[model samples]
Structures are given as C-alpha cells and as structure tokens.
Target: MADIAHTVHVALGDRAYDILIGDSLLDDAGAILAERFPGRRYGIITDDNVARAQLPRLLKSLDAAGLGHTEIVLPAGEATKSWAYLGQAVEGILAARLERGDLVIALGGGVIGDLAGFAAAIARRGMDFVQMPTSLLAQVDSSVGGKTGINSPHGKNLIGAFHQPRLVLADLSTLDTLDARQFASGYAEVVKYGLIDDEDFFFWLEEHQAEIFAGGPARGEAIARCCAHKARVVIEDEKELGVRALLNLGHTFGHALEKDTGYSDRLLHGEGVAIGMVLAHGFSARLGLAPSQDSGRIAQHLKKSGLPTTLADIPGKLGSTETLMAAIAQDKKVSRGALTFILTRGIGQAFIEKNVDGAAVAEFLNEMRALPLSP
Candidate 1:
C-alpha cells in the first residue's frame, strides 16, 4: 500500500465528490468518512466474494473509528445484480432503518456497486451513498461513474439510475487479491481511457504492461490515471448527454455479447469490453474510419494480455449475426431508432457517430461473426 494517496474531484457544484485513490486507502477509510459524513451509520451492501476479500479491512477501519454500520451481503457475481436481489437489498436497507440523510457503502465490484448504488437511489427516495469499490473494474470505471443498474431480460443495464455517490474510495491494494483473469478484465477499462482520448496513455500501457500487472507503484499509478480520466469525463458531462458518451467507446458492442452470454463468468464484463474494443476498431476500419492495421494493433495488444479480442474467442454460443444486431438495436445509445456508436478515426480519436446505418452495422456484425477466432 502506498503511503500517501491521490485525490480526483468530480466537480458537480453541490453534487461534487472526490475519488480517493492509491494503496492503503481502506486503512484511512475511517478517518476520511468520519470527517466527511459525520455521525452517520452506514448500511454496507456487499457480495459474498467481496466480503471475504475486502470486508475485514473496511470493518477494521470502521471499528477503529467507532463508526456503526449495518450490512447486506448478497451472493457474488453478475447474478447478484438482478431485480430479485435488488428488491432484497432495498428491503434490507430499509430494515436497517436508514433515512434520506444516511448513507450506503457499496463494497464490491461492479455488481455490488450497481446493485447497491441503485438501491441507494430508490430507497427512501434516494439516500446519499459512498463507493468503496473492491475490484479493478470498479476502481477504474463502474465505481466512479454512478451509473447504477441491473441487467434486464432484453439487454444489459437496461434498468438503472444516474444517482451519483457522495464519494468514491478505491483502495488499489485490493487488486492484489484479484485472480489473474479479473485483473486482466479490469485492465481493459484502463486501456479504454487511452483508446478513447489519450494515445500516449495507450502507448505507455503497451510499454509497461508488465509493471501494470505486477502489484506495485505502477499499479497504483495506472489505477489513479484511469480514475483521473473518468473523473474528468464525469465532471464535463455528469449525464451521458454530451462528451460522457465517449466513455462507452466499446460498450455498445460489448453489452450485446454480455447479454448473449447471459452475463456470467463465461464472458466477464471487461472480457466483453476487450472483445468489443477490438470489434469497435474493426468496425471503424470497416466504415473507413480507421486503418485496418490500427485495428489489428489493438487486437494484438489485447490478445497478448490474455484477453479475448473476437466474437469467436467467446466461450459459448453468441447466437447469430442477426441476433447480435437485434441486441445492438436495444443499445441505450440509440436515438430515434438510429444507432449511435463511438467509432474512432484511430486510437485516441474516438467520436460519437449518430444515425450510423443499421444495415452497415449488421454487415459489420456478419463479418465479425464470420472471422475465425484469434489465438
């Protein structure tokens, strides 16, 4: 754990919040919260898996600060972000007797953060909450954005809210316990920040992949960097009405794959994002927006990092190109029945492409589906 931490403020006027990054953040959670929240009892919402890994340190901090808290620990994984569990969580928080002035602590990966954050949004007509994201995915992306929701029968994150957290606490040390695949899955989001707008960051990630993987100074730096990028975007467009949509560069395609695969371990969210990013680049090339070699470079980098970069790389059936196209039509980015995608001129030059021809997207899906899986 690093001795000192870095802070990135999401400037939202009265709705502003700070994302505290680096190692040993959990160690300071007590003091940080005591000062900011003041005399509040937090109702923690975590999953079983995250509880085993992160709860002890957080609990120790709360105990050290003499802070009181209630808890709702659900089952782990994407499954936990369902309507059933969401209802359960809301009921549990109410049972804990939290009021509008009270706060909730989302203490896990994207699953817990989304579920709990959404719970905070609807419960008691919206309660203030804090983010204590425990996974690399949460630390870099999901935890900061305040896009809380659960997957719906028709599509991923079809049900969600734009309820922002009061603060975000990302303890980079928590990544040390993540399995290799989980860590790599998160690395996709880190690469996303670079691919979206910062070419130098992408090149730097390419050069220091090893250091980024190895838990140390570089890891903290990488996490902080991603958070900084996300913080800037959130500040610029707290809602997805403008530049904020740039953050979904690969998500339009990624969410379709996730829905097809049932949002299980068969295709983790970040894994889907990795493949989606490659597809985003490949589709951009198909549209003559980016060079073919540029797409190939992106694919090769993801493959080298043990990430799946193609539809064929997916473990199970992903239906057909038509099915994929159907799922894509349901993308939240669609406007007035026209598809919108964040296509790129190249790496670091992503742009919002509104009213992209649906026929062309279908053709692109067909081509991606026809391609052989990369090894």
Candidate 2:
C-alpha cells in the first residue's frame, strides 16, 4: 500500500493524471503501475545520482511484481538537460524497443524529469511517461507541471514541449538522501507557491520551515499543498496561456542567472530562484508597486532557510547587466520581442507584466550589484 498520504488529481480531461505523495511509494510502484497500466513495459530514465541512491528500490519493486523494464542513467545536474542528453534519452528508449503504448518513467529530480519527459514527447512521435520525482524541487514544482523540456545555450528551457505524464509518484523517503544544501535549494520552490498567490500558505511555511527540514509531518502536508495549488493552476491554464504564468514568479531573473552561471553548482536552479524572488519583490518595491519591507521579509525567510537571496550571494564573478538582459530577451515568456515578467505587488500578488521597461530592469540590476548587504 505504500502509505499513500496525499493524491492530487490534475483534471485535464483525457490527459489527466494523479500526483501521489506519500512514504515509500517507490517500493510499491510496481504494484501500482501493474494495476493501473496493465501489460505495458516501462523505460526508467534516471540520472547518475538517483541511480546510485534510489534505483535499486524501484528495480526491486518492479522485479517483485514481475514487471519488465529498462534503465537509462544519464549524468546528473542542469547541463544534462541539453540536446546531446535529450538524444541519448530518446535513443535509449528506441533501442530498448519501447513502443508508444509503453511508459517512460522519469525517476529523478527536475533534470531527469525534464529530459526524460521531453524524450518521451518526441520518441516515436510522443510516448506516454510517468514522473517519479525524487528531489523536493521536482516533486513540488517541475514534476506536477508537465512543462517538459531541455535548456539551450541562449537561455533556460528554450527547447521543450508540454507533455503531461500519465502519473506522478513523489515518495517522501527519497528526500532523506538529499544533503542540507540540496534540500534547502528545493525549499526555495516550496516558498514560491506562497509568493505566487497564497499568502496564507506562505505564512504556514514560515511557521513550519524547521519542521519541513526536519522531515516532520508538516513536510508531507506542505508538498501536498503545493501540488494541489499547482494542479489547480495547471487545470485553468495547461499551457501557461494565462494564470499559469504566475507559477514563474522568480523564473525570469532566475533563468538569466542560471545562464550566467553556466548552470554550475555555483548557483543551483533554486538558489537562483531564491535570489530572483528577492529581486522580483525588490524590483516591485523600487517601482512603487510593492512595499520594500515585503522584500526584506521574504529575503530574511529565504536566507534563514540557507538560500542565497541576493545577487552578491553568488560566488565569483557575474555577467554584466547587458549580458543578463540578453538572456532575459531569450526567455520563453518573451512575446513579439517584448519582455514579459512575473512582477508582484506584494507577497502572493504576482501578475504577468508584458510591457516592462528594459531600461528600468537594466538599471535595477546595476544598482542591485552595488547595493550593500542588508543588516
């Protein structure tokens, strides 16, 4: 039974699926899939990191249930989400002779989910896949959204497709293998849901932050809450056509930082997002749209969670404002060559702004680079 704690259903008619959040779901995945999917075989696509830590458990479950499967282990990290790896994943499925009716199981963090799902989307002209997300970031955000893709040299997620998974299995136990920094990085996304449009959830996160880190009951609840909120938004805007854009509160600035950092460990995706969220709020305040105090408070919470909440927190050197602007220009949100950003009036009040002045953003970046750290 895998102690199923929470299940959030994404009501997308024929493309619909459920996100199962619970303890040890990985150990029960074989049984669950066998019952739900029947005779279909599975191609388990994972990263090197997850293969070492969690692959055995999954294989064991599948073996116990007499289910046939193939494993493709790619290198870990953001760089893996590229054309080379995408081809490798797609080829792996093809070589395994996995038919369109078979399934591709994305069994890792955001990187694996994106790469594998994107591969499934193109392999044999679109195959069904399942998200068995193992990282906190993937479980709460990337895994549920169905926004599968690979990154390009121009910017993040520049090449991709919206291929919803057949199901999502987020096992809480897998988080135990994450180091403090990795866990904290993922927590940044957890905080993002509240910043998007759920002030009450944000407050709850503040109170339960420590408990979540400690792997208390609040951890499961928080994951489920974030999933439910995202599921609702996905239903309303499956393709990021409107309200779903709110889910990218800090992604505009964050993606630029990621490209600037070369997607290295120096700046994790969530770390960039943490700093980006602070920048978003600060930028709003500078424009007289949100109070300055709100940015400070958000920064404080993120910092306390062990995340970098400012440009200065990035190690070594950073790209110039012009460089960042160039990256932002290449962002997916750009429409008709106009910059689009998710700006906020306060916590939980994010809105899509398509006509943001590029000059103001450039000036803000320059100023942010010079500003002293808050005391």
Candidate 3:
C-alpha cells in the first residue's frame, strides 16, 4: 500500500474486476481474496520456479490471514501448459476439496495462469479463480484477459476457453526475482501494447527502457499503461471478433516459431514474440503495409533489450519454410482455411488482415532467412 500502486478496472459489468499492481500485495493476498470471496478456501496452483522464489512469501501471508489453502507445484516451463498437467491441476483442486464456490489462485507465470484458469473453467462446469501473475509477460498480458488454455501440438494456445479470473494481483515486487532474460521477454509484450496503437507510449518506452530495466518507478507506470490498454480493448471486444484481434500482432508468427522449438526454454514466449514482431513489421514493409524504418527501429530496440529479433538468433533448426507455414495455417485466427495476420502500417498502427496471401508470406520468410535482421 505504501509503495505508490495503481488499479486498472476491466469493465465487464457484473464480471468486472480490478487489476491491482504493486508490492506487498502478495502478503495481503488472502485478505484481498477474503474481501472478494468471503469464506472461500483457496487452491493455489504454481510452477516450481515460482514456488521457490515467491510461494513461501505468499504462503506466509495466507497463513497470517488465517486462511486455509492448498497448493500444487508443477514442474516449471512452457511444457507444463498441456493436457497432462491440466489434469494434474484439476485433480489437485478436487483433492483439496475445492467446490464451485471455492477460489483457485494462479500464482505463477502465463503457463500457470492459463492452465489453472482452464482447470477452474471445466471443474464442476465453472468456478472463480484469482490471478497472481509473477512474470512480466503474465502480469502485463496473459493474466488480464480470460484467454486460458494450453499449447496444442499444432499451435500455441490452440486448446483453451474464455474464462476470466475474479481478480488479478500483479505484484511488481515479484518481478525482482526474474532473471534478465525473463524480464526482457516480458518487456516484449509491454512494447506490444504500444505497437498495437499507442505511438506516444512506444516513444516513451524508447526513452525510458533503461529505467524500466532498472526496476525504477517507470516500470510500474509502464505496466499500468499496458494493463489499461488491454482492459480497454477487452472491454470493447470481449471476444476476438474485432479490435481485440489487433492484440495478436506478433502471435501468429510467434506461435509457429514456438511450435518449431517445441515450446521449450530455447525460446520463451516473449522472446518468440520479439522475433515475431520484427518479422511482422519486416513482412509488413515487404508488402508495402508498413515502413521499413519502423520495423528496423523495433528490431534495434528489441536487440538492445537483449531479445532475439531474428530466426537466426533462435537456437536449433527451425525446419523448412513449409513446416513453418503449416504451423501458421493452423493458427486459431485462420478463417475459411485462409491465413489471418495482424499487420501494421507503422509502429502503433497495427491492423488485422484476413486471407493474407500465403505465397507472399512464404516469400517474405524465405527472404528474411537470408537478409540481415538488424533493420
């Protein structure tokens, strides 16, 4: 409470919830939940990495509040966001006797949030859950919208439901534990909000990225801004019927890359996004949809922040052009078997395009493989 925090309201009328951002909120998690869902016991779902660094503190807080709780710690990594572990989480919740009125707290990164939220969705038809996002990517994006699910062997987040959380507690202090790579990966998403539509925010980030990296107050401001943007978009288009689809600017390309890498630590979600965004802008430029300078600047910023901006930067073989194209073809955004992409006119000016020429995309990918990615 003391550290200058902010709350962004996701206006969903009866389903409305506030995204609380700050430090010490984790210690106050139980009280917050008690206020929101009185007399509800909690089932905490987390990954091992988060449990080691963050779970102890959260458990201590819940105990201090005298609230009863149980937790299931899954092996950490993107691999955990699958059907096998979804079953494990559901079984753990049932084992803890979590009823429909009970609460499930997702206390990890995006993977845990998606998996746990999906578990709550199918458990007894539906149940309320809270989001305690620890990673930068989760706090800024995945934890906000009700987009919960696991990766499909065919594509990322191909299997999931639209189940919103009752609340989202994004404790900025939790980010302090993230390694440099994780932090930068999250920043990629932060930059995404700007690239989606906010020209001013993108420029602001260009100037203040160092401060954000240093975990200065600007970091909180940046997170709040990103959350506000997401809340606004979700409010306008709860489903991906229209404007909300703009949010997936880099996801189509990113998902293909993720599938190629087997969704391993070899390429974190945000890292794939970093490269995808560069490719997105690069492709947009190649097709005369956007300016190359805009693409170059974004690539340079991502590179300066220590994220990969090219397929060459990713480790291991990414397979043939057709292999990657097949992955994109399976993207959920595809309609009538035609590819859909979120392209851009420039930074902060992204838009959706249906039935994108598949051959043109393949050519762009082929050219990207050979050209220097610096610009």
Candidate 4:
C-alpha cells in the first residue's frame, strides 16, 4: 500500500495530539505508539469481528516494537457497550497488570474505543490509551475526540467520560471489510463535518460521492478531513462547554430516536444521525430560519449515500408526538426546562437555539412524519 501523507493538529492546551491519516497507518502504529508511550506495557481491547480481521496485523506491529501486550476480545455491536462488558474490559486490563502509565489500545470501531477508553479513564484515575479505529464512523468521529463512555439503560453514551487517547491510528484499509450499510452509515458523519462548518467540503463530498463510496483514496481523504474538523472542535473545547456543541448537530434528535426505538441494530448511530440531520434542517425550515430547499437537498444527499433520511426509515412505528417530545425533553442538551436544539440555517452553518418551544417542536415532528418520501 502506498503511503498517503496527511496530518491534522489538535490543539488542546498542553495535552494536544495530531491525527495522522494514510493508507498503511496500521503498519506504522508500532513507531507511533512507541513514541507516545515508550516502555509502557499495552493492553488491547477489541470486538470479535475486528479481532478476526485486523488484530493479527496490529499484533505483529506491537510485537515488532517489542511492547508487552495482551488482548481482550468482546462481543461486537452496541450491546457490548454496557456496564458488564465495561467491567470485563477493566478486569482484563487489570489481569494483565497494566498500570497507570501503561496504555490501552482500542482496536475496533466506536464500541471498543468507547469501552476501552472509558475504562482507561477510570482505571487508575486516568491512564493513557490509543485509538486504532477500523470503522469509518470511528475514524471520522469517535476516535478523534476523547469523549468515551458506556451506555445506560436510559440512553446511548449516557455513561462515559472525557478520556483522550495518546494517539489515534485510523487505518483506511480496514474499511475495505466494512459492509455496505456500515460504510454508508459512517459516511453520514463524514457529511456532518461539512454540514456544520465547511460548506466547500460538503460540496466536495457531493462531487466525489461515487469514489468515496467505492472506497478509493478519496474515502481516506474524506475521513481525514472529518477527523480534522472534529479534532479542532474537541481541542478548543475538550469538555464540550461551548463550541463542541456544534458537533452534536444531529445527535440530539438522533439519540432521542435511538432511545425511542430501543437502540436496536435496526438503527445504527450514523443512520439515525442521517435522518436526524434532515429533520433538524426541516425543523429550521419550519421555524422560517432556513430554506426548505436546503433541507430537501440534505435529505436527498443522505438518501443517495444509502443512508436513512426520514422518520420512515426509523424501525418502530411512528408513535404519538408526545412520545418523541418526551424523549427530547430528557435530552442532555436541554437545560433549565428549555429544549435546546441544534438548528442549521444552511449547509456549513449550525446554531444552538434554547428558546425553541416544545409544543412547536412536537407539532413540527408530527408534520414531518406526514410528509411523503421524495420521488
């Protein structure tokens, strides 16, 4: 594989890091990990699926670097991001006698990354970890940011902490094994970077959609750009006190939908975000804040990318507006009894509005469900 040189600097006060993007980054992980965590024993946490496909290469790299390492493979999927599995991961790390200075290598998609990273954060009152993101979703979004957590019965990612990784190695080659649905789901987040701040990148993605979906060099570039955008936001606001909220443009709505539907495999995180982004845009349009055409275009783009873009794509039956409204009311974004929504005026522009009326939002969501699918 040819090396593609690209670097994005994440400036987080004194604890900053750089996101390196290339084709054979996994092959270079030994050097990168060694540089950040010299002489530290490492423990790898991964899922069964990823362990089967990518662990051998990672193990070989770790072996070459002469790092003492052990691995714990958990079940794949969102289900694994639970208290039990989190406990199991911590046990595995402890069983390996990993200390505070030792590193935890998260070698799967978001689930493994979140689970392992959170354990690292709490294991010894904060230990270092590295992200070896295999899925596009992890590469573009989760891996770059230090936000790590497990899920609660109430919501996804409800039980986590802000734990930054010592290094993030996003090997594009791993994406080749991702199924089409998973690939498309991850692309929703790639589009999000452009939707929130960089309009040009969004248009660039529109132009190169085919190549991106086909997993060419353009796909790696897109992933890098998205990660860069996220890294910039996280570095500036590591605790999400301000600017980082923009990154959750669709997450509020997406999370609500996920909770209402019971967080099943039927609704992947990115797919929910795809539909949520459209709905958010539509809500902005309904409030006379954005053009309806822009909302339609966003929805159309997601559909073209093979992602769900409407309420219909959500698995469960469309319950009453009251149910959806209740979910929104409990969202973490809400503050002081007001529902704060992330609304977009257009592509590359998004703002958080706390003055939004719950009644009005409920009515709008009800109306959205009534609309017919695009022809």
Tens-place lDDT per residue, model 3, 187-306, is 999999999999999999999999999999999999999999999999999878999999998999998888888888899899999999989998999888798899889988999999
The number of the candidate with the highest lDDT is 2
- True lDDT of residue 116, candidate 1: 95
The lDDT of each candidate is 0.88, 0.93, 0.90, 0.86
**Model 1, 1-375: lDDT tens per residue?**
225567888888888898888677888888888988899999999998888888988889988988998989999989888899999999999998887888999999889999999999999989999999889999999999789999888888889899999999998888888999998898899999999999999999999888889875778788889988998898888878989999998998999888888888899899999988988888888878898898788888888887999888888777887878889998778889989999999999999988689898888888778788896
lDDT of candidate 2 over 1-375, digit per residue (tens): 668999999999999999999999999999999999999999999999999999999999999998999999999988899999999999999999999899999999999999999999999999999999999999999999789999887788889999999999999999999999999999999999999999999999999999999999999999999999999999999998899988888989999999998999999999999999999999999999998899989999999999998888888899999999999888888989788899999999999998999999999999999976544
Candidate 2 residue pairs that clash: none
TM-scores, in order shown? 0.97, 0.99, 0.98, 0.96
Q: On lDDT, who's better, 2 or 4? A: 2
- Candidates ranked, most accurate by TM-score first: 2, 3, 1, 4
Off by over 4 Å in 4: 1-4
Clashing pairs in 1: none
Query: CA lDDT of 151 in candidate 3?
Result: 80
**Which should have the higher lDDT, number 1 or number 3?**
3
Poorly placed runs, candidate 2 (over 4 Å): 373-375
**TM-score between candidate 2 and the true structure:** 0.99
